[model samples]
Target: MNDVKAAVLYAKDDIRVEEMSVPSLEPHEILVKVKATGICGSDLPRVLGDAAHHYPLVLGHEFSGVVEKIGIGVSRVKVGDRVAGVPLKPCFKCHDCASGNFAQCKYYSFIGSRVNGSWAEYVAIPEINALPFDESISFEEAAFVEPSAVALHALQLIQFQGGEHVAILGGGNIGLLTLQWVKILGAREVTVFDIDDERLETARALGADHTINAKNANVDEDWKTITKGKGFAVVLETAGSDVTMRQSFDISANKAKVCFVGTPVRDLTFTPKQFEQLNRKEFTLTGSWMSYSAPFPGNEWELTLHFLKLGRLNFKALIDRTFPLDNINEAFDLYRKPGSVKGKIMMLND
Candidate 1:
């Protein structure tokens, strides 16, 4: 086989386009020809050497592709099928996996993080990870299934009742998608807060009942005014900022449920007095790591496809730009800019 082109990251600010041997498949694996790969927040840490990662890594997990070949044991899909996958591989025998918590499994591996990912012409993944895409779903939209699943899992964690008011602490892709889920789940009001005016405007376009410019305005006071002093029934902290996490408590109503979905780069410190106040107020605090057990409607991929087919989810609006594989560095640079709200920068295969 001819060598395939891939964008590999070596260290901080070091990434290259090179030819690498396309992986030979194991009996339980499948080879996929990558079509569209989306840049994620997690990719930044890996590129900057801030996160623990294996060097010379192919750095993309959010992706959609076409099936190139199937390994011996694969019967679920055939060559030429359009697909997307959750890049997690778990040891099903582990205690966490046994209980249906795959993300918490002891021997969990994630693509782009622990293994070669989609920033290449081809990638080999386990047969179990790949899901067939519906005919109507574009590859670009399919790349969003992973983050959308994260949003869906966050909503599942909160379990908000119908008519409850919810507050989202970011207007990025995850926050915007969660806003749609909140509306689908019947929230009476959804308020989105962001520091960027353009993102705030996008939130309004996406059906947020209110949008607050956190940089210019006092977030807690703005939220308080919007809620008419009642506070919100649920608060989702997707901004991944220590300030936002702390502010979540200040704006939540008594007995409100708070869900933290974003991963912060730095360790956060909370005082005992804060817990005491939360306990006194009967607030329910929880963290949603990632999706684990929720089976897709027909299959996990089918649920994403169904949502897209029914016109319930709009990922097209979320994608702001596309770059060729050779220009991966420029894409990452765009991602690092302050006040950037452009969702899902993609690398297209030529």
Candidate 2:
């Protein structure tokens, strides 16, 4: 009920730790004592670039905590339950929401971006947004639910089937998570492409059959070698860069499924030949938005927790480092250095 330490972003490249009053609960909200929160790739633009929609906001979405208090009408979970926070708050009356496509709801409000969020000692969220998990999963691992659900949601978009050749066009956090999901879903062989050697190694350790350094290798020839010149049956572009976006087309097999899960910041153009790949091969091209489906946050969030408890998601390898709540600025500072962050950087409340 007193002031708590929270990281507030006043402007681009300006974030600081300050004492603020803990959020009060609404009739259906739950007060949570946040234990861990992860900095997402999308946060880079909001923190370092000019993507923030508002100034002086608390910006963290991927988080885990223990329920400290509950609203009068809340009954799904008790005060002592452990839970992962869901960021999407779609307007239930929207057309998309009525159709069970909550991610497409135009009037949706998101945590961290559109409102104050969990880069703090305490956060209050809707009771329905608190997805409880058992004690078998650690708090840090539970914090990964959002990103993991994102990866799964993208695959779910394509009705992803396994036992086929799959190529992931990035070895970053989302790419790494995507790689693991495909492997678990029964992909026969998986190849990860990236410029960083360390990330490639991590991908290999996480079940990638091959890791190609796009910077140093002849990517076109190397991918051909991996697939024996047949091309990938399924390709996921998670880098959001022009290079990888175009590569996703080139490496795809005829009539293959391709999904772009990354958000591109710049305008992308393809050449006549490059654009022809979609027409000639008849590739099924689609892009994935924020993770959500029927029944609110959907199976994506539920299955992520299920896998985490089963010890299959490998959250430990995806976390690069952890910092205390007071040093949240120091965590943002890492994003300024090129290629400095190899994985998720977490802020722990304790």
By TM-score, the best candidate is 2
Clashing pairs in 1: 296-300
Task: Give me the runs in candidate 1 sitting further than 4 Å from their true place.
Answer: 271-275, 294-302
lDDT of 2: 0.93
RMSD in Å for candidate 1, one decimal?
Answer: 1.8
**Runs of candidate 2 exceeding 4 Å displacement:** none
- State the number of backbone clashes in model 2: 0
Q: Give one digit per residue, the lDDT tens place, for model 1 in 189-257.
A: 999988888877888888899998887757667787899998888999997888788878878899899
Encode model 2's per-residue lDDT on 1-350: one tens digit a residue.
67988999999888889999989889999999999999998998999989999998999999999999999899999999999999999999978899999999899899889988999899889998999998899999999999999999999999998988999999999999999999999999999999999999999999999989999757778889899998999999998998899989899999999999999988999999999999999999999998899988899999998888888889899899999988977887788789899999999987
> Which 10 successive residues of model 1 have the least lDDT summed?
294-303
Candidate 2 TM-score to native? 0.99
